[model samples]
Target chain A: MVDMISMPDDSTTAVDRALDAVLTRLAERAIPRGAAALALIRAASDATTGGKRFRPALVVAAFDAFDGDRGATPGLWDVAAAFELLHTAFVIHDDLIDRDIERRGVPNVGGTFRSRARSLGVADDGADRIGDAAAVLAGDILLYEAARLVAVADIAADQRVPLFGLLDDAVLVSAIGELADVEQAVVPGEPETTQLLSTAHDKTAVYSFCAPLAAGAVLAGADAGDRAVLMTVGADLGLAFQLVDDLIGTFGSEAQAGRDAGADLREAKRTPLISLARETSAWPQVSSALALAPTGPIAVRAAQRELHESGARDRLVALIGQTLASVRRRATELPTEPRALIERLATGIEGRIP
Target chain B: MVDMISMPDDSTTAVDRALDAVLTRLAERAIPRGAAALALIRAASDATTGGKRFRPALVVAAFDAFDGDRGATPGLWDVAAAFELLHTAFVIHDDLIDRDIERRGVPNVGGTFRSRARSLGVADDGADRIGDAAAVLAGDILLYEAARLVAVADIAADQRVPLFGLLDDAVLVSAIGELADVEQAVVPGEPETTQLLSTAHDKTAVYSFCAPLAAGAVLAGADAGDRAVLMTVGADLGLAFQLVDDLIGTFGSEAQAGRDAGADLREAKRTPLISLARETSAWPQVSSALALAPTGPIAVRAAQRELHESGARDRLVALIGQTLASVRRRATELPTEPRALIERLATGIEGRIP
Candidate 1:
């Protein structure tokens, strides 16, 4: 019955619906003061941490994938929204650390605050300081709100204990990855690109992929063994998604990228393409290509050629495909969710231009 | 029997006992690996939030003042430590926003990380990124630790309800104050010094004074009214402490001031003295006087005179005295802590300079 509307399977749609419901509640009640309300609204509006809301889709889809009555637990929606809120909080902090301003058109929370402060007649320098501080707290508030939502999930509180513990552990691990990424950029040792990607995976994949999916699965009657599979699948899928992001960051159009082309080159972000590009034997061609690459189309095209000649891009894509295959295998086994829906969402993202 | 040891009423002894226990435990723990350890240690080591252990003192004093039986609870120490942890977290993040750098001769968490990143072989730009990121997480780690500690407080879970709720509320209020301070600084408002101080009171005093002292009093069995009185006391004391700190920042000898002098001017931090100094008929004299203030003995003398003449320092001292008197009067109905011992400790700080 749940399979009829592809909308039911849409992780993005499901998460958004759930998140909106939760946010609506916050808007209606959480804060009464004008300033506090505005701060929250500003933070909630920042979608920087979220990517495609695919993880959230997994949360809802995983529940639908179950054998239980489809609409029985209306309360479960807020639970799923909780994950999205947590994800949003994570992204807020991430954007700040990345220093790549602007997300989804509006300035990220930090930038937004800076702009808002300026509008309020704050000086340039002081605005930045104020913006950053407010943004940090805004993120903190979202995190707390996320916890509050999660705590009220319809599932048996005792059963959700492990999930709560895991969520906290994941928070700690993801933070470590961010630290490592920042530290790596500062240090001289050109550690293997594998290390950088691993940091990305640790910081992102498990939580975005496995946790949300497995949590929904757990609510839907999945056991410990099922969680292990989901984690592996999620890690692979997460890596693939990140590589796609890196590719897009290097090659997408100005409006599409939401950041500068080759920002990684200037920021020295350790991307698979850059890691491979720097090591090319066609050294002069690659360097000149990198230097002359002005627009996104040109840079991406140049990067694409360099990658193919060096065989790095192919290897990276092949690696991505392999990871997706494992993810597909999990999707196939987990019939609780609409199989066609999960497949469509995952595969379709790889093809999305912007 | 409880009086046999004659514990001083000074906030430090209580805080020291609480802090020493926690740090010792932290040193023995696994530290959770990689960047997590750094995050945790940096949180524990923050000096701006550092105090003479006053909060833990307040908590204990509250317990004493309310006739809280020493033998009643198993985890009173943990309770006191929890308040201190929360207070320290507030201080660390506060300093990050202020960007003053030096706190008691050691570089702040952000500054320390930036320098150490390079020393650890991280590159300069990368180190800067790492530092900001660390400061952000370090704040979170402290916040997380405070929650964990408070969760274990010895009070019956039901009785601890107010404290639990207070802990959460404090985070929100503090964040609002922070946001306001940031916005206010940028806007260059002509807010009277009292209004400016009120922002500080809400952000710093309410939690620094009202919350911890009230938490202590609650545990010690004080009535609601008693808690209110303690808040008034803590508020003034906190204001005084902040004012003195500001004076020290602008005018103290480098040896005593630590960190960067004239940091307030550079950051445009909204301190009471700065606000007052900005005022006055001797405007150029005050401004030029500020610019010429040296980092050592001469700087201290010049700063003292400027602050004194501007009337800001005198106002602050007067406010502090008033608040303390009120706290003393309100404290009468409540059971006394070791008053003689506390008075002795207070006397020691008396002639040491406001």
Candidate 2:
């Protein structure tokens, strides 16, 4: 009856059910005073609509692996949902900062609101301002709502503080990561591999991976040593995941990625792959491709070819493999269920790169 | 030792001490990257400075008023500092949204960063982008720090959840208020008085007034009924505070307010005073004055004179009086210390206007 090998087999369905419950609660509560407030709420709701639910799965997987009778613990559902909502908030704000008009092959919260501004007959700059303002508010509210869900989760009273702290720390570290990203964009040369990796750790690893794992472990009243190990494993997994994401952003098909493939190049994002690519003689071509304002397919293909020729793609794949190997080594020290699940997660991340 | 009548007389010292402690911790924990991340942290630290610490004062006052051994509950200090930090985050973001160059008679976070970009030889648009990005990241980190402080406050385990909930609610409601404010600005005519007040309640009331009061009460383990009363009193006081703020923004000298005297009119902010003035026969003159591109001294004075002549100032004063009166009526239902503090706060708000 206790099938621990599958690790998050049913967690997705449970998490989705919980997310819908949260949406239902939000829908029932009327936003006071009128259409504008409602519009922000609608945008927020839309932002929470679709995502891969990867982070939440890690949370439930961690919780399930450590705690007994995982099916009996209902609080895991809310925690998972909260994690997804928090990710949505970050994505919305990230798009606004990058000035990207689309996400998941559709208009993002900012783009959708910008269209609304135009329909309202606002001037171009005016419409942009309105769109930006609306998206900022929407992101702000969603972040708050995410925390609120966690606070109200049916977890033990003593468990709530650490959980909330984990979420808060994620935001703080991610903000630092984002700031570093902006800085790297403005500077002349490419950021080194270590610097780029550190930013990825701060921005995506700790929050998207470590926090979820540590939070789930803490919620199950796990020991400090167990929690620390899980966190370490999560950090490595998260780094590997970010590397894979960069590869997809730089070289994957737009049809497969569901967004602009050349966005990283156009924005001159200093990803680890690009950082590694810059170390070779192909730096000039890579630099020019990145410098393109509205990066065309021709530029993207040229950049891809240059990166491949420089062996940067191979280097990135090897790096990802090394990270997963580290995760696997760390997993050996964990309990049976968690060890299996973590190894499976590592495999999943490894499979995503090419 | 209680000193009930002098609610929060020593709170400023305590709150300042705690705020300093927070900043010191932030400075010591090195962001593991480059100068840009460090610069954002520095800008965030600067943003936390020079404010009146108004919301923190409210939190301490409410706590001091109700709980015995007012100075003994050191957790109040952390709660107070958190409120102020939260306010700083909002102020930074608000300045970015409004594109304001100055705040408190000096360059704000955005302006300071923009100057940095210019000094770095970035062009005008690039500098603006850098400024906006930095401010947004700064605001995000500050908000996270604010919540983290509260989460780690020296309160009971059961008490932590509600305290965190209150902070989260404030952010959610305030975001809604901010959205309404943006919508009102973009629309053609002046916003109705009721709509303006609702926005005020959402923006200023929940965060500035109610959250502080309720947080203080929860820290003291106050009952639901007492908390409810404090929140209500806070709502009324917050509305009155906004009315006074609008008056100062409109008619007071820059020296008196530590900001531009006519910024509200310049931004075409639809304040309650302006709403009332628009009802008078002075509509055309007031409209033209508000529509001024630079809103030079001449136009500002003209707008001021028109408002005064239209009896808008008098009506605003009367409105403040009514709000304070309502606050007093509610204060009478509170315990002795809270009653005295509430009445005194009302008196102070009333004295702020002309």
Q: Highest DockQ: give the candidate number.
A: 2
**TM-scores for every candidate against the unseen true structure:** 0.77, 0.91
In lDDT terms, which candidate is top?
2
Residue B345 CA displacement from its true place in model 1, Å: 11
Candidate 2 lDDT by residue in tens digits, B253-279: 786556677767666677888888878
In model 2, the Cα lDDT at residue B52 comes to 74
- Indicate the TM-score of model 2: 0.91
Instruction: Give Cα distance to truth, residue A313, candidate 2, Å.
Output: 1.9
lDDT of 1: 0.62
* lDDT tens readout by residue for model 1, B76-191: 67777776676776776777777745566677777788777778787767777777787776666556556555644456544455675556556666777777676666675566
Model 1: DockQ score: 0.35
For candidate 2, the lDDT comes to: 0.76
